[model samples]
Target: MKQSRLPHRFGKERGRNKMDKFMDNPWFVRIVAMALALLLFLSIQDLGNKSEGSRPNGMESNEVETITAVPLEKYYDSENLVVTGMPDTIEVTIEGQRRFVEATKRQRDFTVYVDLSDLSIGNHRVPILYKDFSEKLKVKVEPVYVEVSIQEKVTQEFPVEPEFNNNILAEGFEAEQPIVEPNRVRITGGKETLEKISYVKASIDAKGLIEETIKRDTKVTVLDRDLNKLDVFVDPEYVTVTVPVNNPRKTVPIKIKQVGSPPDGTVIKRMEGDIEEVMIFGWTDNLQSVNEIEVEVDVSEVTKDVELDVPIKRPEGINKITPERVKVKIVTDKAKNAETNLSEVPIESKGLADSLDVEFLSPVDGAVSIKVVGNKDELKKAQEGDFEVFMNMQGLRVGDHEVNLEVKGPKDIKWELSTEKAKVRLKEKGTV
Candidate 1:
């Protein structure tokens, strides 16, 4: 058995030696290495395929994002059909691979719209639709549907009125008829909406108190009679509004008013102001009510003939009084200065309440005798008609009150009242 096994072992060793020689050969080594490499490559490809197949449709893990305020659009016959009651915006949510979700959110190149083309003039409920986005994204919108109104479109030409802020005018200025470059506007809207149109106006832009004429580019606005805003499209959406500002002027006489009494025994013979008339600047409406401006002069300490400078006070609604100061010459003397009485001067009420009546409690007759002193000859010519006596009851109420008396008389005459103050009672009308 040993002898037989030795021959077999010898033969096996010889075969192994042959096999080792074959393995040592470069061509044989190259072929075997290639075969092993091919097997490894094939195995790797199979494993890769299996790994990829394990995933659903070879997609990566999913991600989600929400996009807000996506604008909603409509498709309709805009020339003839007007649609309303559609949401201006909607929210869109998308879920997909992380890369796609991020890209879709970043790009935001999508449109959410409603189809109104097939619908007639009426209300309809429709589903919101979207396009221009990646198909791989699972997109969902917050508002899936909208109800809209369709109406027959109508267009009409309406006169465009110009609206201005009169408060913006300068103190002495007035606004003229505003001129619009295109005085009329063409508005397009639903027939029913157009029927409700009441005003189409362009508001002039006034940055400040306007002193001169100006032209401004202003947008057009449409509204109903109640001033509620109406939705419509106006052709030539902007127009130039020409606002002409007029500064009216007038020349009026200036009156020198005397306050306070002169020295004892002294009487004013003549009071003259160098500024006889002044040019006034103000609105035309205000100028209509003014005929003269007054400047007060005090002659309490004036003893002899003298000249003095007095400042001018601009009355209400008078923008400017030219020559704010003036020279007044006062002549006073004791000669021919005698006081005379103007009797039974009836009292007049000023600034009294419309719902109340007043009674002079002290002078029950509401009459007073005043002493007028001038060049005695002039005093003879003065009468009760030349004087007006009253008290300011503007802020007085129902009560017993003592109020000072005010007198308006000839400029040259000095008047002394019988009483400096009068007691009065204010009671509501139609009462005892």
Candidate 2:
């Protein structure tokens, strides 16, 4: 048994020795290592070729980027034509290599504009254009085409009328005519649009206005006849509106006061104003205290007829006065007098109530005697026809009434009437 087990063990040992001999062969190990190295090299080469083939035509990987708020420029015959309906800005999306996209977004080295140079005076569809960008970039604008209206350019002058809300003025206060600086404006626009222009006005809000002049910068608007706003260009877009607001006004007579006596050789025959009265605006209290406006005239230096411009004295709290300065004529004649008496000067009645009539009862001829005194030359020029004596029968009842006779004559003469009171009877129309 021992000899047989020894052979089997020797056989197993022989088989193990054969496998060890095969594993220890250097040429086989060298072949296996070479195969593994060749497989790894092939794999690396394949990967490189695939990567190079993926990028065709020497192009690089691309990315998409969007740029916003890019201003749009226009090119056309702007001097002779006006263009409208063009957008101010647009957005552009670009697809290109990462480096170019980033550079384009950062540097903004591109231009977007519209070309209307070839368009005529009418509606036109113009294409948006772009240039001065990287050649590798593909750009797409948000709006590819723009609609524009081309019109013939024209210029016209329009008066600027000031407008305001009158209801906003303070109570008991009134506004004079508003004054606009640069009363007219030159407007340039389309010829068709200009034809429709009715008015150009400067609007001011009178809200919260009191007894003061309101001055403010107001925007100008162009409108049509129907008050519809029109699209136009104004050279002066704004104007200054000066609204003069004040209290109620009153017109009063200008009283001429003599400050000094006339020259020794000359006497002031008459002093009269060119304008009889002036309108003034002031507070209620101040107006109530004022009855008439007075201007003082100095006659000490006056020897002959003289014309002077006298400034009106304004009361405190008065806003304004019309005809601030009045022309006064001072008539002086030589100190020589002549008297003339005219008898039976015809008398008249005036300002009688429409429903009543008056009849003169005392003087049977309805006339009076008048005596005139003045310079010899002036007295020679005077006549009975120059005098008007009448009784104002205003507000009298239908009965006997005693009315004073009013007389008017030349400013340079002194006139005396025969009687101061007139006896008259008043009666209704139907009864009389």
Model 1 TM-score on a 0 to 1 scale: 0.64
The root-mean-square deviation over C-alpha atoms between each candidate and the true structure, in angstroms, is 11.5, 17.0
Candidate 2 least-lDDT 10 residues? 1-10
Tell me the lDDT of candidate 1: 0.87
List candidate 2 segments past 4 Å from native: 1-65, 206-211, 225-229, 249-432
The TM-score values for the models, in the order shown, are 0.64, 0.44
Task: Write candidate 2's Cα lDDT for 1-432 as tens digits.
Answer: 565455788889999999889879998799989999999999999999999868753477679988999999999887999987888899999998788899999999899999888888999988899999888889999899999889999999889999977787765567889999999999998888899998788988855656677898999999999998877789799999999987777888889998876654577878999999999886666677778998899887889999999899887766678989999999887778778898898788888888887778877578999988777777889888889988887678889878888998887678888888888888988785
lDDT of each: 0.87, 0.86
Residue 321 of candidate 2: its Cα lDDT?
88
The lDDT of model 2 is 0.86
